[model samples]
Target chain A: MRVALCGNPNVGKTTLFNRLTRSSAPVGNWHGVTVDVIEKRITGTDVILADLPGCYSLTARSKEERITRDGVLFGGYDVVLFVAEVNNLRRNLYLLTQVLEARKKAVLIVNMLDEARGKVDLELLSTRLKIPVVGTSERAKNPKESVLEAISKANAPSLPYLNEVAADAVARRAAEKNISPEFAALKLEERDAFIADILQSESSQRGCYGCRGCDRDRPSALRYSYIDKTLDGVVSCRRRYALTDKIDKIVLGKAALPIFFLIMTAVFFVTFETAKPLSSLLGRLVSLAAEPVKNADMPEWLCGFLGDGVIGGAGAVLAFLPQVTLLFMLTMLLQDSGYMSRVAFVSDGFFKKFGLSGRAAFSLILGLGCSATAVLSTRGIAQKTARCRTAVVTPFVPCSARLGVFTAITAYFGLPAITVAALYALGFVAALGALKIMRLFRASEGEDALLMEMPPYRVPSLKRTFKAVFANVCSFAVRVGSVVLGVGAAMWLLSNFSVRYGFTGGSGSSIMSTFAGALAPIFKPLGFGDWRAVTALISGVAAKETLISVISSLGGAGEVFGSAIAAASFLIFSCLYVPCVATIAALAKETGWRYAAVSAAAHTVTAYAASLIFYQSARLAQIDMKLFVVIWSSVVFAAVAAAVAHKIYRVKKRKGGAHDSAARKERK
Target chain B: MNLSDYSLKRGVIVSVGCDDDTHRRLVDMGLIGADFYIKSRRGGAALIDYGDFSAVTRNALAREITVRER
Candidate 1:
């Protein structure tokens, strides 16, 4: 049987889906986590269950809601498991009522019942709704069996409030469109933009078609009145002092930004400082594993391939596994604890100034985990312009794959924490800066709506946290096995073999050098213009982890850059350059090929210019500090002067235009 | 008064006067003719509790929702 799970946002649909399907799709304690439909088969049954995005009602507004509406209404599911949270059952039941009005077979699952603590009378609820009701919680030992059992006997309840006039209108619409009267009732009653467009197309008439005088709010009002009556005896919510209120006072208060900063600092400390020993141990283990090949009395070329190409390259990236695991764990904690929502809530105003909503915060945070996946999450953004802008800039934030590269390069500077943190901060600033620049080109589409859910804070589940971290580690291991291994071996072969001297076993006059040499001069202004740097950068486009591996094979960053300033410039360039092919493909999928190509070009050009400026400034400082200070002051002064001049010019032009228009009007 | 102009935290929603899309969404959430509570406001967005759910809406939406202070 084909079953689908649908509900309002953050009602634990994904949690139930994971339990029933034995799959680990991501679950967060906030709304909009599942932006698209995900499907999986039940563990033992032949039932394929699809998890649709959350919607307030069948009348879709946002992209996510549209997806859910289309899927639930027409995805050919045998039954729908409509999940609702106990705390918000009234609002959730609004959607349930709409589903019933549309004549869909659905079973109501009142979730988070543990929090309800017997306040909800499931028997009464089931009796009133005339459908099978199952009360469940995250701790339910076997909710799947009960849920599936309920689904097998799914039925649609009658919404008795469709009066004669409404019934006639629905019937007329049904006859005209050849659709079911139940669906027609919903379409005509809501008469939302989507339904209006459909009606407009159904008739090529210039005027509103099918239904007239059907008040848009009447259906909702009637349904809510019915719901209030049904819920009157079914629920008895005692007014208890909520802890969420107390927490919000502090979390969403004036100090929210500072607290967020402190929390991020703590996360970084745990990732870098606490995990340092584990990373060192892993590094030593990799070196020990490669020692046997280094000591073997084999052909020099074969030794280099085995000892350096495969083991050394992959191992270098692998050494940072501890940091990656810890970072992912902490990020999941913040997400699952519900603190991330507050951050979004607090940051909304600041983000709006840059032509983004607070919703972009989630995408940017996820970008720290994976740019490709983060770009996909931008679909939850309500405004198309905001979504497009967010997708374009998500790659500017360094993802986990680039972590190893940053750590390796910054190690040469000896202030790993400070330098790495500055680089991350720079990435965020650059992303915001890009958005500000994008705002100049694309006009605002009015104020973007943010009807966000503020889920009560809960202790993040340990099982989910570990599962998420394990997934990250598994994906990283897979990359090491495939992309890193292939690129490492190929780079090693190219650098070691020459056309004339068959196996030179070094980079001298080799195929890799010849190609990299051609690309070196383009980066000469950034100070790391060596052929090895060029090769690592090119391999990085394939996968960021491959960059670190190639760097390890070509010798460490210390050998590649040779100077502190050059290393810093390379780090900045890496931070701002185009993301891996996977992210670009994801961007293309979310936006389009034209946008993806242009964004990639924009990122590369921006990275190059920034790196060049940094390198030149650093070189100037090395030569004479006074000269460096003077040049920087002059640039800053000139920029401010230009901005002021432009503002004055625009003001004068506006005044002149007003005067001319007034003169013309007087003459008329 | 509209929700954005209501100084008191607790109120009752009178009507929603937004564009069709946003008005429909607000109505679907049962915000009309229900007890409303403003939980917080930041960055021109307000977190409102109505019926059994709380939602954060931007100021533009808040301004279009008429309410009577409790």
Candidate 2:
């Protein structure tokens, strides 16, 4: 039997799904984490469980919402497990009522029972709603027994409620108007085309005509009236209870914010500083493993390629994998505990003023971990224009790859670690400022309701946290494995090949030098217009982390610290420059090439302009600005100019609206 | 008028339709509650105020919901 778990967003539906199926999918308190549908089988039963996207009602408002709607109505699941928040029974019933209306075999799983505080009258609710109710707390309780019991009791066929008179009237209308009862009802209710089409098709097949004897136009009004009357007796809620408010007071009251900050700071501190020893240990193990290969009677070329080029380049990235994994785990823990949603809510006021939704805050936070994934995460934002704008600015949010660059640069400049951290903060501030400027010209015409749920605060589970972290890290490793391999080999070839001289004695005379020199002038103002910096930026195209490998290959890892401040400036420029190719491609797929091109150009110019200003200002202040500053500043200046140009283009296009309207009309 | 302007508190079913942009989104998401409940409210960033228990920012919430205060 196929079972589908369905619920509104942030109801711990995914958490319960993970618990029941023992699957390791990432769960977030924020909405739209599970954008696509996932299916898995129960171990003992012939049951396949489908986890549908969290939606308010099955009415499709976005692509994710439509996925849930179609999954429920047409996906042919044998049983629908309706997950709801126990504390918010009245609102949860909105979707539950839809499930009943669909006539789908279903059972109610009231999750977060631990947080419910016995406020819900489950027996009364079950009897009134005419469905079996099972209470569960995803954190503290094992929902296995309750879930199994509900499934065993799911023998009855699904029968959704309709207002009695309205159902009869729809039936009569279907006969008279040649529409099916369902179709007629949906049409009368003025539901979306998908629902209307479903009903209409059913009625047409049944040989129903048009609305002849029935009042077809007034069906929705009559049906709602009928529903309102039924709700008078069946549904009741207490005004004074304020369960969520009380919970919030206990969890996120004024003190909760500080506690949250402490936890987040602790996560960053532990992941970055404490993980160093573990990461070094892992690096040593990898090096030791490679020693035997080096000692083997392999060709000199093979040894050098495997030991230095392949393993070295890849190991340089892999050494940080432990830290990345730890970071992901901590992020998932915060998310699972539901504090992340509160963070978004608390920060929404600040972010929205910059023409971004609170959701963008989540993406920017994720960007600090990995910009590519952060770009993908923007799928959760409902408004297309806002999502694009967020994508445009995301690269500025210093990702993990850039973090390595920062460390290398700090060592090069002999600056304090706090200075490196301050640079990161500077990048964040710059990103927000850029977003505000981008918003002025590219204001999102689309309106997105920023509805999110504050999932009841609970201590995160080690099992779930590890699972989520592992999944994210594994995906990142796979991506890095492929991209880094290709980039490593290419860099090796570029460093060895000299067109006229054949194999170059050193990297300076190799093909990479030629290419870097050709592009050096573009970044001259930022003080890093040399071949080494240029080559690093080029390799960064493959994956941002590849910059570390390129830099090491060109100037050795020791040079990272000697040029510390300039290197730091370079890192900042690299962070804000064009996103890796994969992100550009993804943006192209989501929006269009035009937008993607614009995004790339804007980032490159912004990085150039920002670096230029930073270098110039530092130099004038008598700060020991290094050679890398010139190149960095030039790139930053270009980025600013491109952003300004793009803004102007958008404004002009908006003012040229008649042409746009004509084009839209033509498309229609 | 903004949703904040209304006296409607929790548990009240408000009648509100999405403006042009939100309308397209609601139509896409299959959100049926042109009329629905005010699930919860806090002084800071209204949480899960309407439409299938989804959390919405107060700014967006201000534009999307209009309460029928009793």
Candidate 3:
């Protein structure tokens, strides 16, 4: 038997799914995590459980909506589990009504019963809706039992409830307008054209009839009346208890924001502080494991290859796992508490001035974890231009992989930790500026508004948090291990091989060196124009983290950070350069290779330009004055210039377009 | 009156004009009823102060919804 879990966004559908299937799907605080359907087979039964995207309705405005609609209509699931939040039954039922209309067999799983605290009249709700409703919670001690019971009893048939007046109105409108009842109702409700077309076709086939005043003429009015009548009989709530407001007050009140900051700061402190020892420990283990092999009278080539190429490359990636895992856990917790959504809510206005939607803000937040995954996460956005623009700007957010690179370089340069923070901030500012500029020129098509829900706060489940952190760590390990290993081996071979001259013995003698040398002159104006810097740039294409590996292999981390200013310049360049191969692939997958190429070209040019400015300014300043003052001046200048230029360009272009159109009309 | 004219500080009841799509959506969501309250405003998004469950909506959408301060 096939079972599909469906619900409005953030109705605890995923938590319930995880509980039922014992799966570790990332349960996000907001909507859109499960945009694509995920299928997991139940252990004991022949039942296959499909987790469909959470959607507010089946109206299908966004990709998530479309996916859910298609899944329900054609995906051939045996049972549909309609999950709803106990506190928001009315809003939840809006989508439930649509599912019922689809004539699919369904079971209502009213989750978050802990939040309900026995206040919810489940029996009344079930009687009124004429469907069996089961209350469950992720926090429940025996959630598995409740879920298993619900699944066992899922053989019950569907009971659709549509108010008599609304049903009559739909029928009347369908007949009067010669449209299908569904289409006529949707049209009255001001639904999208897709629904209109469906109704129009049906209406046209069924001949139109005249009515003095058909109920269909006022579909919205009829719908409201039907909903009101239904609620009057079935739904009830205490006037004093507002679930969302009460939860928000406890979780995100004025005091909560500061606490959140403190918690995040602690997380960062622990991650960075603990990573050094962990990295050292792992490094020692790797070297120790290789010692016997090194001592063995193996082939010289084989010893060097295994010892340096494989072991060294893998070590570089694995050393950072501690920090990455910590960061993921913290982010997951913030997400679970619903604080991240609040951050998006607060940051929306700030990001909007740059022409980015609120959803892009969420992707930026995710970008801090890993740019490739962050780029993948952009699929949640519906607008093509916004998604593409987000893809282009994501790399500038500086992922944890880049963080590892930054830490290594900073340690080498003897640069203060604050400089690292400053560099990250610089990247963020640059990305925001670029996003604004891109949006101004591109001018997003259609009216794309951001509508999001602020889910009631709940303590994050440890099992789920651990699962998310582990999944992220595993994926990162796989990526860095395979890609970095290949690049490392290739680099070693290239450096060791000689065609016309004696083996150069290092990257300096390799083919990459020849290319880097060729490109070195082009980047001389940007400062740090040595072959090593150029090679780092090239290696960065494979993966941003590989730049650090190349640097480490060439002359250790200490040599790369010889000077604070140069190190700063290097960090800036790395942060802004072409996104890693994975991100480019993701961009290609999302918006075609043409767009990917364009994005790469745009980012490379921007990075080069910014690095040139930074290096030149530093040279003029002579690194004598306070580093903070110099950094601040440059940042402020860039921010102002970017903001002004973006606004003026957009305004001028719009006026010019309008004027030209007017002139052409007059001439005509 | 224009939406900009009313001093609807988020948690106030407001009337809506017919042509605003945002207002229409709010009305559909049951935010435009006479007794609904505006809860809070942060970063241009307002939460409707529903007695039992609040609805958060964008300020641009809110402006389309005319409200009388209670």
Docking class of 1: medium
lDDT by residue (A196-305, candidate 2, tens digit) is 45445443322122221123223333334433443454434434335555666555555755776687678767776777777777668767866776677977556656
Across A130-224, the per-residue lDDT of candidate 3 in tens digits comes to 66678777777646555556666654333332333244545664566443355345444443345545445443422123221233224344444
Per-model lDDT: 0.83, 0.66, 0.67
The digit string of per-residue lDDT tens for model 1 on A1-668 reads: 99889999999999899889987888898888898999999988999999999888887767888899888767888888999999887889988987887678889999988777338889999988889999888876868788888988899877777543245654665557544575565556566556546544343211233231237667787888889888997888555327777888787777878888999999988888888888878888988999999789999888889988999999999999989999999999999998988878888889989887888999999999999989988988878888889999999998998888888667646755788888888889989988989989987787775467778878888988898789779998999999999998899899888888788766569999898989999999999999988998989899999988998887777888888889889888888898899999999988899889978988898889889999999999989999999999999999999999999999999999999999999999
Candidate 1 residue pairs in clash (backbone atoms < 3 Å): none
Looking at candidate 3, what TM-score does chain B attain?
Answer: 0.54
Q: What level of docking quality does candidate 3 show?
A: acceptable
**How accurate locally is residue A447 in candidate 1, as Cα lDDT from 0 to 100?**
77
Task: Output the number of the TM-score-best candidate.
Answer: 1
Which CAPRI level is candidate 2? acceptable
Write candidate 2's Cα lDDT for B1-70 as tens digits: 4466554554333333544334433332323334444444444356544433345546454555444543
In model 2 chain A, where is the ten-residue run with the lowest total lDDT?
A205-214
**All DockQ scores:** 0.53, 0.28, 0.31
Query: Which residue pairs in model 3 clash with each other?
Result: A178-A203, A179-A203, B11-B38, B13-B68, B14-B66, B14-B67, B15-B66
What TM-score goes with each of the models? Answer: 0.94, 0.75, 0.82
Per-structure clash totals for the candidates: 0, 61, 7
